[model samples]
Target: MTMFTRNDKGQDTASPATAQPVRSDAQPAASPVAETRRPQAQPISSSSAAHGTPSVSVISKALKITGQLESTEDIQIEGEIEGDVRAVSVMVGANAKVKGTVRGDQVQLAGQVEGKIEAKKVILTRTARMSGDVVHQDITIESGAFIDGHCRPEYGKAEVKAPGLKTVVAGS
Candidate 1:
């Protein structure tokens, strides 16, 4: 005998019917809880975020780099570097130290560099202590800066060729 039986009206009672199968091409309806918890995509705005200025790579005083550093943007060094550095602009902080070549379009030194510096524009502040040659198109040395090598204004020019060789007579 069935557990459920007919009522006075002669209609049998049963469980609810199963849900219909969803179509392959149709999108499923989202539940209210799921819809409320979903995150919405927002358009990014410059004023709310970082502007057009490219981010600069900074080497803080507590760190040191033993390998080369190359960047298309600016670099500010306040630590120690043992290998070469090439960037668009390099700024050596007052307490920084660099023992390798520094090459860039603009270089501003206020610390110590024991290697060469090659740039289109070089600025040596009062606290600068440089011990190697500087190859630059334009340079500014403050009154208290110390330099131990020659400052050559040859950046993009070929090495100077020796004057015309003097002809030597076999017998004079």
Candidate 2:
């Protein structure tokens, strides 16, 4: 149910941290898999690449892919995606809708996302309507944004207050 969103630029973004919950203990990791994606192994255009970095990949909206999606570039979800998704950065377009788990280094939600979303930074725009738990390092909920879920900002610093927990904003 996971799909890749490659914009006009050569970058593909999808986070890979939604598969597991936060753990305080260390555990063994999986072996790295070697896959070949370089078709011609040629230099890429500066405009199509991110920050002048070379990239080689293409994913259109007509193709609806499933299962786990992992990438190291920028990705835009314009169609629909189910299951888990991981990438460097993800942008869910206004008409795009995603169900299941979504993970990325940076995620911007403009459409509708159902399920859990984890990222380094998450932005809930005014047009976004989400129904799930969100955990990130930094989060922004716009004035008109509607989100019916729990939120946790990691930042890797102080512990986040959970639901039902007492929280006092500003001064009394």
Candidate 3:
């Protein structure tokens, strides 16, 4: 006599050997549907909506910067800067203040600058208050603008070096 035996209902179930195998061709047919369900991701573009010009860095009125700022793009300042600023294009907004020099390809001022400005083109609006010298290839100063230092059109030109300054003798 056997110690164990299968029940009547259990013996009616299908065995593993009778199970059907999956076809390899079915995988390829379903791949296109899987690909269509997945969404294609894209990269985010520029932040500014304007074209032809790159993104601009804005210095708001409530902020203040103590060190030098250098950029290859444009900059708009409506706050206070204690140190120098260098950019391709620099625009000083009304009521802004800059203590050090500003150097750019194009510099537009409508505020106060206690230091010098060096650029290819400079425009001083009526509300501008500049206390230091301006060196530019071309400059435009409004009638009401206040300037305490000389405006020299000597940018990009070979000018006489100041005394007591070390001059670099190139090709030596």
Candidate 4:
């Protein structure tokens, strides 16, 4: 048998570009290895497996919140809040305003807070206007700051649970 197959009109019409060698065993052609292979998965490193990095959340001047805000990272507020805020560090900008409690490890205020502040370290800048109580372990108030409430060094004196820690009840 010849390598080229004949057409119905009995003419040899095999061209070099359109010709493929035929095998005697009659097996189908194999596909490329890349087409049938699966992609390899990347290994996870220890650094990538852990919590990647600490983040800083910002509340801009145009926004306002009326509910509670809590975070494990830092927070910078330049807006208005009508509820409590809890974070690792909190910075209230000069033109910002808050009408509720602010709780953190460190709290630096340069705006107006009409409620309470509970923190380990608290700083009231020159432009800070506070009209509520401040409970802190350490505090610094500038000369030009205005405060109208009690300043008590009562932070950590009570049993306070951290932001994300689970509290277990002993008795039913």
Tens-digit per-residue lDDT, 80-124, candidate 2 = 777776666788877777887777767898888899788878998
| TM-score for all models, in order of appearance | 0.63, 0.55, 0.62, 0.63
User: Runs in model 3 with CA error above 4 Å?
Assistant: 1-54, 159-172
Residue 91 alpha-carbon offset, candidate 2, angstroms: 0.5
Local accuracy of candidate 3 as per-residue lDDT tens digits, 103-163: 8889999999999998889999999999999998899999999999999988877772221
TM-score of 4: 0.63
The digit string of per-residue lDDT tens for model 4 on 1-172 reads: 1222222112212322222223211322232112222221223544443454446778999999999888767889999999998888999999999999999889999999999998989999999999999999899999999999999988887554333412322123
lDDT measured at residue 73 in model 3 versus the true structure, 0 to 100? 70
Off by over 4 Å in 4: 1-54, 159-172
Residue 158 deviation, candidate 2, in Å?
A: 12
Q: Write the number of the candidate with greater lDDT, choosing between 1 and 4.
A: 4
Q: Which residue runs of candidate 2 sit more than 4 Å off their true CA positions?
A: 1-61, 155-172
The candidates, ranked best first by TM-score, are 4, 1, 3, 2
The stretch of ten residues in a row with the least summed lDDT in candidate 3 is 161-170
Residues 74-163 of candidate 1 have per-residue lDDT tens digits of 799999999998777899999999999998889999999999998888999999999999998899999999999999998655762211
What is the Cα-based lDDT of residue 163 in candidate 4?
38
Which candidate, 2 or 3, has the higher TM-score? Answer: 3
